[model samples]
Target: MIPLRAGTVTEVAVLGAHCDDIAIGMGATLLTLARARPGLRVRALVLSGAGTERAEEERRALDAFCPGAELDLTILDLPDGRAPAHWDRIKNALAAFRAGARPDLVFAPQRGDAHQDHRVLAELVPTEFRDHLVLGFEILKWEADTPAPTVFHPLTPELAAEKAQLLLKHYPSQAHRDWFDEQAFTGLTRMRGVQCHAAHAEAFVLDKAVIDFGGS
Candidate 1:
C-alpha cells in the first residue's frame, strides 16, 4: 500500500457523540499520533454524557489515550440518543470549537453511522470545519453500519494491545457491555490489520481530501 503522509501535525481535533465512541473508533490512531508528535495539542469534544460518570470516564480515558499530549476535552450535557432534536446546540458547539483553533486533522464519525446521534454529529462536523482534512472513524456496534474505510493506519501488536488495555482500564462504567471486552476490540483491530497487511490497525473513512503534487 502506498503511504499518504500528512504534514507536521501540531494539533488535532477529535469529536465523539458519546463517551467511549472516540476511544473505540480511533483510540489507536490517537495513540500513534501522540507518540509520533510529543506535546501534540488535542482538542476533543463529546456531545453527551456531561455532568455524569460517563463524562468523567471520557476525561480520564482521553488523558490515557493521548499520553503526553496537551489534551483539552469538553463533554457536553446534550441528551443522549437525542441529538437531532438539539440541532442548534450541536451546530453552535461545533462552530465555536472551529473558531477557537485550527487543527491539522479532525477525527469524527461518518454520516453513514447507524446511530442517529452519531449520524447527526457527523453530518454537522464538515459544515464547520470546511477545508480541513476530516477522517471519519467507525464504531463497531450491533447495528449493521460499518462502512468500507478508504484509509488505514496500521498499528503494531503492542500498540493495539495497549489501546485495548486502556479502554478496559479507564472506563469502568462501560465494563458491563458485552461487546466492550478485550476480545471484541482486539478482534476488530486484527481484522482491520488483515485488510491493510499489518499485525493490527485502525481504519477510517476519508469523505474528502485535497492532495497536492505541485512538483509533478
Candidate 2:
C-alpha cells in the first residue's frame, strides 16, 4: 500500500468529463479519505451535465459515497463526444472556477486515456491546477487502456468490495453497462494486488515528480 501524501485533503478538487467518472476512477480513494480524515472537505467538478440517466446517478452516488462532504459538481452541458472542440470555453471556465482556491490535491483522468472526452478533460486539469499535485486515474472500459502505473494504493478486499458495491448500488443507471460491475473493478484490483504484493490494490500513474522518495 503506497500511503498517499495527498496532504491531508481538507481541500480537494475533482474534475470529470461526464459523470460517475470520478466515482469510478477514485471511489476507493474517496472512501479512504472520508474515513481517515473525517473532516476533509471534498469538491467534484464536471465540465457538463447533460440529461442522461447515467448523469443523474453520478450526482446521487457522490452524495451517498461521501455524505456531508462539500461537493460542488458542475456538469457542463456541452455536448458529449465534443470536449476537444470546446477547448477555449473549458480552459477559461476551469480557470475561472479554480481562480481563488488552491486545492491540496487534484484528481482527474489520465491524459493518455484512449477516450476522447477523458483526454480533453485531462488536458484541461493541468492548465487550471498548475501547482496542485495532480494524479491521473484510470477507468476500465472497452478500451481497457492500462498505462504503466507507478503509484499503487493498497485496499483490503473488503474495502475494494465496498468500493465496488458503492459503484454498483449508487450508479443504477449504469448497471446495464457491464464494467460498472463490482466484479470487474474487483478483478482489476486483484490483478494490481499481485503487482503490489497485496490482497487488493488500485494503481495510478503520476504525470510528474510531485516529490521524490521520502520527500527528498
Candidate lDDT (C-alpha), each? 0.92, 0.80
lDDT of 1 at 100: 82
* Residue 133 miss distance in model 2 (angstroms): 0.9
Candidate topping TM-score: 1
| Model 2 segments more than 4 A misplaced | 1-4, 212-216
**Each prediction's TM-score against the native?**
0.98, 0.90
lDDT of 2 at 59: 83
lDDT of prediction 2? 0.80
User: Which lDDT tens digits does candidate 1 get at residues 1-216?
Assistant: 999989799999999999999999999999889988999999999999999999888988999899899999988999889999999999999999999868999999988999999999999999999989999999978888979999999999998899999999988888888888889999999999999999999999998988888877
lDDT of 2 by residue, 26-109 (tens): 888888877777666777777766666766887888877676576666666877788889989888878877874567888889
lDDT of 1 at 69: 99
